[model samples]
Target: MTDKIYNVLFLCTGNSARSIIAEALLNRAGKGRFRAYSAGSQPKGEVHPYTLDLLRSLNYDISDARSKSWVEFSADGAPQMDFVFTVCDSAAAESCPIWPGHPITAHWGVPDPAAAEGSESEKRLAFADAHRMLGNRVNAFVSLPLASLDRLTTEGRVREIGRSLSEAG
Candidate 1:
């Protein structure tokens, strides 16, 4: 792979939470390393309000955030993804789109923040945790020598990276 910035897609069932966090983190983390996008296997039709709040609190420019379908990326003219990660446990287990460019796929499931119970603070905590965990993983991923890793090495590394992202932070 050349040193050009690679496109990454993070998917979930809703596209309203985890996948959105992952996308925002990667995109804000740098300018020309990894271009991130997100979608849902079954979109919830709107980006979650809490998701927007968390990003804004961190000063992330999320004015453009919205829930979208993974099918867009499946199109021939869409940005060719170098990596496609399903950020929801449900989406990770469900069927995925047959991608163009054969992007390296991984699963980095984070428990749904919207599913968090209790008070508002507790729900915020869940979002914060997911945001941090995904942020850490995306940070580490972009730091990897993706352009240098060989084919077999990259495939194995993608899984390793996913585990590291899911378990860390």
Candidate 2:
């Protein structure tokens, strides 16, 4: 296996829940092989409480999980991403910055847990569900034979993963 580490960025409108969840999931699940980061088109300036709670309960480090703009990734000297996935419908629909390396992009849109209306328990459940969906997608991503597949094949596979799993809910 090649020693190259893939860099991934997850995008969302808020960067509070779904995108943060995906970042944490991939960083943990795809450790050594992949590094994950998250950003928003319109940042909320802080991660959602439910998102922090869910990730903390799962033992993920939340020290660096602040909500920030995608512009940060597009700026000079920023890490070049190999993949970018939009985890919310709004973010997917909006115009995004031209990434430095022209990363393979896909929409893995999921319901916004922050927008979940109900009791506290119900809100928490929404975050948990987002985590579960993102976890499955990230796992499938890390399992891909990236070094063997051509760019076209890899892009198609990534798109398929988003379509199949994001549509699950």
lDDT per residue, candidate 1, 42-124, as tens digits? 89989999999999999998987999999988887899888899887889888787888788888877889989999999999
Candidate 1, which ten residues in sequence have the lowest lDDT sum? 160-169
Q: lDDT of each structure?
A: 0.86, 0.92
lDDT of 2 by residue, 1-169 (tens): 4788999999999898999999999999987799999999999999999999999999999999899999999998999999999998889999999898789998888888899999999989999988988888888889999999999999999999999986674
Off by over 4 Å in 1: 1-3
Misplaced by over 4 Å in model 2 are: none
TM-scores of all models?
A: 0.94, 0.97
- In angstroms, the error of model 2 at 9 is 0.5
On TM-score, the leading prediction is: 2
